[model samples]
Target chain A: DVKVTQSSRYLVKRTGEKVFLECVQDMDHENMFWYRQDPGLGLRLIYFSYDVKMKEKGDIPEGYSVSREKKERFSLILESASTNQTSMYLCASSLGGKGEQYFGPGTRLTVT
Target chain B: AQSVTQPDIHITVSEGASLELRCNYSYGATPYLFWYVQSPGQGLQLLLKYFSGDTLVQGIKGFEAEFKRSQSSFNLRKPSVHWSDAAEYFCAVWSGSSASKIIFGSGTRLSIRP
Candidate 1:
Protein backbone atom coordinates (compact mmCIF):
# COMPACT_ATOMS: atom_id res chain seq x y z
CA ASP A 1 0.00 0.00 0.00
CA VAL A 2 1.13 3.54 -0.71
CA LYS A 3 2.07 5.32 2.47
CA VAL A 4 2.41 9.02 3.22
CA THR A 5 3.61 10.03 6.66
CA GLN A 6 3.52 13.41 8.32
CA SER A 7 6.02 14.57 10.91
CA SER A 8 3.49 15.46 13.60
CA ARG A 9 -0.09 14.55 14.25
CA TYR A 10 -0.64 17.66 16.34
CA LEU A 11 1.29 20.87 16.92
CA VAL A 12 0.88 24.06 18.91
CA LYS A 13 2.68 27.31 18.12
CA ARG A 14 2.66 30.85 19.41
CA THR A 15 1.92 33.88 17.32
CA GLY A 16 4.80 35.04 15.08
CA GLU A 17 6.60 31.74 15.63
CA LYS A 18 7.79 29.74 12.72
CA VAL A 19 6.17 26.34 12.21
CA PHE A 20 7.28 23.47 10.05
CA LEU A 21 5.30 20.40 9.02
CA GLU A 22 7.10 17.63 7.21
CA CYS A 23 5.75 14.87 5.00
CA VAL A 24 7.34 11.82 3.47
CA GLN A 25 5.99 9.42 0.88
CA ASP A 26 7.28 5.95 0.21
CA MET A 27 5.71 5.54 -3.23
CA ASP A 28 8.16 7.80 -5.02
CA HIS A 29 5.36 9.91 -6.45
CA GLU A 30 6.14 12.89 -8.64
CA ASN A 31 3.62 15.27 -7.10
CA MET A 32 3.02 16.37 -3.52
CA PHE A 33 0.49 18.81 -2.10
CA TRP A 34 -0.28 20.67 1.13
CA TYR A 35 -3.76 21.67 2.16
CA ARG A 36 -5.44 23.15 5.23
CA GLN A 37 -8.82 21.75 6.12
CA ASP A 38 -11.31 23.66 8.21
CA PRO A 39 -14.86 22.97 9.24
CA GLY A 40 -17.32 24.23 6.60
CA LEU A 41 -14.41 25.53 4.51
CA GLY A 42 -13.20 22.13 3.40
CA LEU A 43 -9.70 21.38 2.12
CA ARG A 44 -8.08 24.40 0.56
CA LEU A 45 -4.82 23.96 -1.26
CA ILE A 46 -1.85 25.78 0.17
CA TYR A 47 1.05 24.71 -2.02
CA PHE A 48 2.20 21.89 -4.25
CA SER A 49 5.54 20.59 -5.47
CA TYR A 50 5.83 18.81 -8.76
CA ASP A 51 9.56 18.15 -8.50
CA VAL A 52 12.50 18.74 -6.27
CA LYS A 53 13.11 22.46 -5.66
CA MET A 54 9.97 23.26 -7.63
CA LYS A 55 6.96 24.73 -5.87
CA GLU A 56 3.66 26.29 -6.93
CA LYS A 57 1.24 28.37 -4.88
CA GLY A 58 -2.28 27.08 -4.48
CA ASP A 59 -5.54 28.85 -3.62
CA ILE A 60 -4.54 29.78 -0.06
CA PRO A 61 -0.75 30.25 -0.04
CA GLU A 62 -0.73 33.65 1.62
CA GLY A 63 0.79 32.75 5.00
CA TYR A 64 2.47 29.52 3.91
CA SER A 65 5.50 28.38 1.93
CA VAL A 66 6.74 24.95 0.95
CA SER A 67 10.10 23.22 0.49
CA ARG A 68 10.98 20.23 -1.61
CA GLU A 69 14.68 19.70 -1.07
CA LYS A 70 14.38 15.96 -1.73
CA LYS A 71 12.12 13.72 -3.74
CA GLU A 72 10.75 11.65 -0.85
CA ARG A 73 9.96 14.55 1.45
CA PHE A 74 8.09 17.84 1.36
CA SER A 75 7.89 20.51 4.01
CA LEU A 76 5.33 23.22 4.77
CA ILE A 77 6.46 26.33 6.56
CA LEU A 78 4.48 29.00 8.21
CA GLU A 79 6.82 31.99 8.32
CA SER A 80 4.94 33.53 11.23
CA ALA A 81 2.14 31.60 12.79
CA SER A 82 -1.08 33.41 13.51
CA THR A 83 -4.33 32.49 15.19
CA ASN A 84 -6.11 32.29 11.87
CA GLN A 85 -3.55 29.83 10.53
CA THR A 86 -4.61 27.05 12.86
CA SER A 87 -6.20 24.18 11.04
CA MET A 88 -5.77 20.56 10.08
CA TYR A 89 -3.01 20.38 7.51
CA LEU A 90 -2.98 17.51 5.08
CA CYS A 91 -0.21 16.21 2.85
CA ALA A 92 -0.81 14.14 -0.23
CA SER A 93 1.28 12.55 -2.97
CA SER A 94 0.37 11.13 -6.32
CA LEU A 95 1.93 9.80 -9.49
CA GLY A 96 2.17 11.77 -12.72
CA GLY A 97 -1.10 10.37 -13.96
CA LYS A 98 -4.52 11.83 -13.22
CA GLY A 99 -4.99 9.06 -10.71
CA GLU A 100 -6.09 9.20 -7.09
CA GLN A 101 -3.87 10.76 -4.44
CA TYR A 102 -2.59 9.10 -1.29
CA PHE A 103 -2.61 11.30 1.80
CA GLY A 104 -0.90 11.34 5.14
CA PRO A 105 -2.63 11.18 8.50
CA GLY A 106 -2.56 15.01 8.75
CA THR A 107 -1.10 17.53 11.21
CA ARG A 108 -3.46 19.53 13.37
CA LEU A 109 -1.75 22.88 13.95
CA THR A 110 -3.01 25.12 16.68
CA VAL A 111 -1.73 28.68 16.79
CA THR A 112 -2.10 30.50 20.09
CA ALA B 1 -11.84 27.91 -14.30
CA GLN B 2 -12.84 24.37 -13.29
CA SER B 3 -14.70 23.81 -10.03
CA VAL B 4 -16.74 21.24 -8.11
CA THR B 5 -19.82 21.56 -5.90
CA GLN B 6 -21.52 19.33 -3.37
CA PRO B 7 -25.03 20.57 -2.81
CA ASP B 8 -25.60 19.01 0.59
CA ILE B 9 -23.52 20.07 3.53
CA HIS B 10 -24.72 17.13 5.64
CA ILE B 11 -26.94 14.08 5.23
CA THR B 12 -28.44 11.71 7.78
CA VAL B 13 -29.37 8.17 6.94
CA SER B 14 -30.18 5.08 8.97
CA GLU B 15 -27.87 2.13 8.89
CA GLY B 16 -28.70 -0.23 6.01
CA ALA B 17 -30.51 2.55 4.20
CA SER B 18 -29.61 3.59 0.69
CA LEU B 19 -27.38 6.65 0.35
CA GLU B 20 -26.71 9.16 -2.36
CA LEU B 21 -24.53 12.25 -2.37
CA ARG B 22 -24.82 14.87 -5.09
CA CYS B 23 -21.88 16.49 -6.86
CA ASN B 24 -21.74 18.90 -9.76
CA TYR B 25 -18.93 20.46 -11.77
CA SER B 26 -18.40 23.40 -14.03
CA TYR B 27 -15.72 23.09 -16.71
CA GLY B 28 -15.37 23.91 -20.36
CA ALA B 29 -14.51 20.42 -21.44
CA THR B 30 -15.11 16.93 -20.16
CA PRO B 31 -13.72 16.70 -16.63
CA TYR B 32 -12.23 13.98 -14.49
CA LEU B 33 -14.25 13.63 -11.29
CA PHE B 34 -13.57 11.75 -8.07
CA TRP B 35 -15.23 10.88 -4.78
CA TYR B 36 -13.24 10.75 -1.56
CA VAL B 37 -14.10 9.81 2.00
CA GLN B 38 -12.44 11.08 5.14
CA SER B 39 -13.07 9.59 8.54
CA PRO B 40 -12.77 11.73 11.64
CA GLY B 41 -9.27 13.14 12.05
CA GLN B 42 -7.95 11.05 9.16
CA GLY B 43 -6.76 11.70 5.64
CA LEU B 44 -9.12 11.41 2.73
CA GLN B 45 -9.40 8.13 0.82
CA LEU B 46 -10.38 7.73 -2.80
CA LEU B 47 -13.74 6.01 -3.16
CA LEU B 48 -14.25 6.22 -6.90
CA LYS B 49 -13.32 8.14 -10.04
CA TYR B 50 -14.83 8.96 -13.41
CA PHE B 51 -12.48 9.69 -16.27
CA SER B 52 -14.22 8.26 -19.32
CA GLY B 53 -15.89 5.11 -20.58
CA ASP B 54 -18.83 3.69 -18.60
CA THR B 55 -21.10 6.09 -16.77
CA LEU B 56 -21.62 3.85 -13.77
CA VAL B 57 -18.46 2.87 -11.91
CA GLN B 58 -18.01 0.57 -8.93
CA GLY B 59 -15.56 1.49 -6.26
CA ILE B 60 -14.19 0.14 -2.99
CA LYS B 61 -16.22 -0.23 0.22
CA GLY B 62 -19.52 -1.04 -1.41
CA PHE B 63 -19.69 2.39 -3.01
CA GLU B 64 -20.43 3.46 -6.59
CA ALA B 65 -20.86 6.63 -8.61
CA GLU B 66 -22.56 7.66 -11.82
CA PHE B 67 -21.27 10.30 -14.18
CA LYS B 68 -23.79 12.26 -16.20
CA ARG B 69 -22.32 14.48 -18.86
CA SER B 70 -25.58 16.20 -19.66
CA GLN B 71 -25.95 17.46 -16.10
CA SER B 72 -22.25 17.85 -15.44
CA SER B 73 -22.65 15.81 -12.29
CA PHE B 74 -21.12 12.77 -10.59
CA ASN B 75 -23.26 11.45 -7.77
CA LEU B 76 -22.15 8.74 -5.34
CA ARG B 77 -24.48 6.01 -4.22
CA LYS B 78 -24.44 3.02 -1.93
CA PRO B 79 -27.11 0.36 -1.88
CA SER B 80 -26.76 -0.12 1.85
CA VAL B 81 -24.79 2.22 4.06
CA HIS B 82 -23.15 0.85 7.13
CA TRP B 83 -22.43 2.72 10.34
CA SER B 84 -18.76 2.75 9.45
CA ASP B 85 -19.61 4.62 6.29
CA ALA B 86 -20.23 7.78 8.24
CA ALA B 87 -17.65 10.30 7.17
CA GLU B 88 -17.03 13.43 5.13
CA TYR B 89 -17.39 12.99 1.40
CA PHE B 90 -15.67 15.31 -1.02
CA CYS B 91 -16.04 15.58 -4.76
CA ALA B 92 -13.15 16.79 -6.89
CA VAL B 93 -12.65 17.70 -10.53
CA TRP B 94 -9.69 18.00 -12.89
CA SER B 95 -10.05 19.16 -16.46
CA GLY B 96 -6.80 17.78 -17.76
CA SER B 97 -6.77 17.17 -21.46
CA SER B 98 -3.15 16.24 -20.89
CA ALA B 99 -2.49 17.52 -17.38
CA SER B 100 -4.75 19.04 -14.74
CA LYS B 101 -4.88 20.45 -11.25
CA ILE B 102 -7.56 19.16 -8.88
CA ILE B 103 -10.31 21.33 -7.42
CA PHE B 104 -12.37 19.97 -4.53
CA GLY B 105 -15.88 20.60 -3.31
CA SER B 106 -16.70 21.91 0.13
CA GLY B 107 -17.70 18.34 1.13
CA THR B 108 -20.75 16.58 2.58
CA ARG B 109 -20.69 15.16 6.08
CA LEU B 110 -22.53 11.85 6.27
CA SER B 111 -24.22 10.94 9.53
CA ILE B 112 -25.37 7.36 9.96
CA ARG B 113 -28.01 7.15 12.66
CA PRO B 114 -29.20 3.76 13.84
Candidate 2:
Protein backbone atom coordinates (compact mmCIF):
# COMPACT_ATOMS: atom_id res chain seq x y z
CA ASP A 1 0.00 0.00 0.00
CA VAL A 2 1.08 3.52 -0.73
CA LYS A 3 1.48 5.66 2.33
CA VAL A 4 1.40 9.45 2.19
CA THR A 5 1.98 11.31 5.43
CA GLN A 6 1.72 15.00 6.17
CA SER A 7 3.78 16.88 8.70
CA SER A 8 0.78 18.39 10.46
CA ARG A 9 -2.90 17.61 10.73
CA TYR A 10 -3.90 21.10 11.91
CA LEU A 11 -2.16 24.42 12.04
CA VAL A 12 -2.86 27.99 13.07
CA LYS A 13 -0.93 31.03 11.95
CA ARG A 14 -1.23 34.77 12.14
CA THR A 15 -1.73 36.91 9.08
CA GLY A 16 1.32 37.60 6.96
CA GLU A 17 3.14 34.65 8.44
CA LYS A 18 4.99 32.13 6.39
CA VAL A 19 3.57 28.62 6.64
CA PHE A 20 4.89 25.34 5.44
CA LEU A 21 3.03 22.09 4.88
CA GLU A 22 5.10 19.01 4.29
CA CYS A 23 4.22 15.73 2.65
CA VAL A 24 6.17 12.52 2.23
CA GLN A 25 5.33 9.46 0.22
CA ASP A 26 6.81 6.00 0.57
CA MET A 27 5.80 4.77 -2.90
CA ASP A 28 8.57 6.63 -4.76
CA HIS A 29 6.07 8.21 -7.10
CA GLU A 30 7.34 10.73 -9.62
CA ASN A 31 4.48 13.22 -9.38
CA MET A 32 3.46 15.19 -6.29
CA PHE A 33 0.60 17.67 -5.95
CA TRP A 34 -0.76 20.24 -3.53
CA TYR A 35 -4.41 21.22 -3.40
CA ARG A 36 -6.72 23.26 -1.23
CA GLN A 37 -10.23 21.97 -0.64
CA ASP A 38 -13.14 24.26 0.10
CA PRO A 39 -16.80 23.68 0.58
CA GLY A 40 -18.80 23.68 -2.66
CA LEU A 41 -15.62 24.34 -4.63
CA GLY A 42 -14.00 20.91 -4.55
CA LEU A 43 -10.27 20.34 -4.65
CA ARG A 44 -8.36 23.00 -6.55
CA LEU A 45 -4.78 22.37 -7.49
CA ILE A 46 -2.24 24.80 -6.06
CA TYR A 47 1.03 23.37 -7.31
CA PHE A 48 2.60 20.17 -8.55
CA SER A 49 6.08 18.77 -8.99
CA TYR A 50 6.94 16.25 -11.66
CA ASP A 51 10.54 15.73 -10.59
CA VAL A 52 13.05 17.06 -8.16
CA LYS A 53 13.42 20.84 -8.59
CA MET A 54 10.72 20.89 -11.28
CA LYS A 55 7.46 22.62 -10.38
CA GLU A 56 4.35 23.75 -12.22
CA LYS A 57 1.56 26.09 -11.24
CA GLY A 58 -1.87 24.61 -11.10
CA ASP A 59 -5.18 26.44 -11.45
CA ILE A 60 -4.88 28.33 -8.16
CA PRO A 61 -1.19 28.77 -7.48
CA GLU A 62 -1.34 32.32 -6.25
CA GLY A 63 0.01 32.97 -2.71
CA TYR A 64 1.61 29.51 -2.67
CA SER A 65 4.88 27.90 -3.72
CA VAL A 66 6.24 24.39 -3.67
CA SER A 67 9.56 22.65 -3.06
CA ARG A 68 10.65 19.20 -4.20
CA GLU A 69 14.26 18.92 -3.17
CA LYS A 70 13.95 15.12 -2.98
CA LYS A 71 11.84 12.46 -4.61
CA GLU A 72 10.05 11.40 -1.43
CA ARG A 73 9.22 14.80 0.01
CA PHE A 74 7.10 17.72 -1.22
CA SER A 75 6.51 20.91 0.68
CA LEU A 76 3.97 23.67 0.16
CA ILE A 77 4.87 27.17 1.25
CA LEU A 78 2.68 30.18 1.81
CA GLU A 79 4.70 33.31 1.26
CA SER A 80 2.33 35.49 3.28
CA ALA A 81 -0.55 33.72 4.85
CA SER A 82 -3.87 35.55 5.01
CA THR A 83 -7.23 34.75 6.49
CA ASN A 84 -8.44 33.82 3.03
CA GLN A 85 -5.71 31.22 2.85
CA THR A 86 -7.29 29.13 5.56
CA SER A 87 -8.27 25.82 4.05
CA MET A 88 -7.84 22.10 4.15
CA TYR A 89 -4.66 21.34 2.27
CA LEU A 90 -4.06 17.96 0.71
CA CYS A 91 -1.00 16.33 -0.76
CA ALA A 92 -1.00 13.58 -3.34
CA SER A 93 1.50 11.46 -5.23
CA SER A 94 1.19 9.33 -8.31
CA LEU A 95 3.34 7.41 -10.74
CA GLY A 96 3.74 9.42 -13.92
CA GLY A 97 1.64 7.13 -16.10
CA LYS A 98 -1.60 5.99 -14.56
CA GLY A 99 -3.16 9.20 -13.19
CA GLU A 100 -4.04 7.33 -10.03
CA GLN A 101 -3.00 9.45 -7.02
CA TYR A 102 -2.64 8.49 -3.39
CA PHE A 103 -3.41 11.21 -0.86
CA GLY A 104 -2.22 12.04 2.61
CA PRO A 105 -4.44 13.08 5.47
CA GLY A 106 -5.14 16.78 5.00
CA THR A 107 -3.87 19.67 7.08
CA ARG A 108 -6.55 22.11 8.15
CA LEU A 109 -4.89 25.49 8.16
CA THR A 110 -6.30 28.47 10.02
CA VAL A 111 -4.85 31.80 9.16
CA THR A 112 -6.05 34.38 11.65
CA ALA B 1 -10.35 22.06 -20.26
CA GLN B 2 -11.59 19.02 -18.34
CA SER B 3 -14.19 19.38 -15.58
CA VAL B 4 -16.44 17.24 -13.39
CA THR B 5 -19.84 17.92 -11.86
CA GLN B 6 -21.46 16.06 -9.02
CA PRO B 7 -25.09 17.20 -9.15
CA ASP B 8 -26.29 16.16 -5.74
CA ILE B 9 -24.79 18.18 -2.93
CA HIS B 10 -26.18 16.02 -0.18
CA ILE B 11 -27.92 12.62 -0.09
CA THR B 12 -29.48 10.61 2.69
CA VAL B 13 -30.17 6.90 2.69
CA SER B 14 -31.15 4.37 5.28
CA GLU B 15 -28.84 1.53 6.00
CA GLY B 16 -29.34 -1.44 3.65
CA ALA B 17 -30.88 0.83 1.02
CA SER B 18 -29.60 1.06 -2.52
CA LEU B 19 -27.33 4.02 -3.18
CA GLU B 20 -26.56 6.03 -6.27
CA LEU B 21 -24.55 9.21 -6.62
CA ARG B 22 -24.69 11.13 -9.87
CA CYS B 23 -21.59 12.53 -11.57
CA ASN B 24 -21.28 14.31 -14.90
CA TYR B 25 -18.15 15.35 -16.71
CA SER B 26 -17.05 17.54 -19.61
CA TYR B 27 -13.99 16.70 -21.62
CA GLY B 28 -12.81 16.11 -25.15
CA ALA B 29 -11.71 12.67 -26.32
CA THR B 30 -11.57 9.62 -24.09
CA PRO B 31 -11.08 10.86 -20.53
CA TYR B 32 -9.93 9.13 -17.39
CA LEU B 33 -12.66 9.07 -14.74
CA PHE B 34 -12.34 8.40 -11.04
CA TRP B 35 -14.44 8.37 -7.88
CA TYR B 36 -13.08 9.22 -4.46
CA VAL B 37 -14.49 9.23 -0.94
CA GLN B 38 -13.34 11.49 1.88
CA SER B 39 -14.26 11.07 5.47
CA PRO B 40 -14.67 14.10 7.69
CA GLY B 41 -11.32 15.82 8.25
CA GLN B 42 -9.57 13.24 6.09
CA GLY B 43 -7.96 13.19 2.70
CA LEU B 44 -9.61 11.76 -0.36
CA GLN B 45 -9.47 8.02 -0.98
CA LEU B 46 -9.76 6.42 -4.40
CA LEU B 47 -12.90 4.40 -4.74
CA LEU B 48 -12.63 3.38 -8.37
CA LYS B 49 -11.44 4.43 -11.78
CA TYR B 50 -12.54 4.00 -15.42
CA PHE B 51 -9.94 4.16 -18.14
CA SER B 52 -11.38 2.12 -20.99
CA GLY B 53 -12.54 -1.27 -22.26
CA ASP B 54 -15.41 -1.64 -19.81
CA THR B 55 -18.15 0.83 -19.11
CA LEU B 56 -18.94 -0.61 -15.70
CA VAL B 57 -16.22 -0.42 -13.07
CA GLN B 58 -16.21 -1.93 -9.62
CA GLY B 59 -14.62 -0.06 -6.74
CA ILE B 60 -13.69 -0.54 -3.12
CA LYS B 61 -16.18 -1.19 -0.34
CA GLY B 62 -18.90 -2.54 -2.61
CA PHE B 63 -19.06 0.60 -4.68
CA GLU B 64 -19.23 0.74 -8.47
CA ALA B 65 -19.58 3.30 -11.21
CA GLU B 66 -20.66 3.06 -14.82
CA PHE B 67 -19.37 5.19 -17.60
CA LYS B 68 -21.80 6.39 -20.26
CA ARG B 69 -20.20 8.04 -23.23
CA SER B 70 -23.43 9.28 -24.71
CA GLN B 71 -24.44 11.01 -21.53
CA SER B 72 -20.96 12.03 -20.50
CA SER B 73 -21.74 10.67 -17.07
CA PHE B 74 -20.06 8.35 -14.57
CA ASN B 75 -22.44 7.71 -11.71
CA LEU B 76 -21.44 5.70 -8.64
CA ARG B 77 -23.64 3.02 -7.15
CA LYS B 78 -23.72 0.71 -4.20
CA PRO B 79 -25.89 -2.34 -3.62
CA SER B 80 -26.61 -1.43 -0.03
CA VAL B 81 -25.76 1.53 2.08
CA HIS B 82 -23.86 1.13 5.31
CA TRP B 83 -23.16 3.52 8.14
CA SER B 84 -19.52 3.58 7.19
CA ASP B 85 -20.41 4.74 3.68
CA ALA B 86 -21.28 8.18 4.88
CA ALA B 87 -18.72 10.52 3.44
CA GLU B 88 -18.10 13.12 0.75
CA TYR B 89 -17.82 11.61 -2.72
CA PHE B 90 -15.95 13.38 -5.48
CA CYS B 91 -15.82 12.68 -9.20
CA ALA B 92 -12.74 13.59 -11.15
CA VAL B 93 -11.52 13.60 -14.74
CA TRP B 94 -8.20 13.69 -16.50
CA SER B 95 -7.59 14.40 -20.17
CA GLY B 96 -5.47 11.26 -20.76
CA SER B 97 -2.33 13.25 -21.34
CA SER B 98 0.65 12.49 -19.16
CA ALA B 99 0.97 16.09 -18.02
CA SER B 100 -2.69 16.90 -17.79
CA LYS B 101 -4.07 17.77 -14.39
CA ILE B 102 -7.10 16.01 -12.96
CA ILE B 103 -10.18 18.12 -12.20
CA PHE B 104 -12.46 17.31 -9.32
CA GLY B 105 -16.15 17.90 -8.70
CA SER B 106 -17.61 19.85 -5.81
CA GLY B 107 -18.50 16.54 -4.16
CA THR B 108 -21.65 15.01 -2.71
CA ARG B 109 -21.94 14.50 1.02
CA LEU B 110 -23.58 11.18 1.76
CA SER B 111 -25.48 10.64 4.98
CA ILE B 112 -26.40 7.16 6.11
CA ARG B 113 -29.29 6.68 8.50
CA PRO B 114 -29.32 3.70 10.78
Q: What is the model-wide C-alpha lDDT for candidate 2?
A: 0.92
Candidate 1 lDDT over residue span A1-112, tens digit each: 9999999999999999999999999998888999999999998989888889988888899989999999999999999999999899999998866867788999999999
Worst 10 residues of 2 chain A by lDDT: A93-102
Pairs in clash, predicted candidate 2: none
Fnat of each prediction, in sequence: 0.53, 0.53
Clashing pairs in 1: none
How does model 2 score by TM-score? 0.97
True contacts kept of 1: 0.53
Worst 10 residues of 2 chain B by lDDT: B94-103
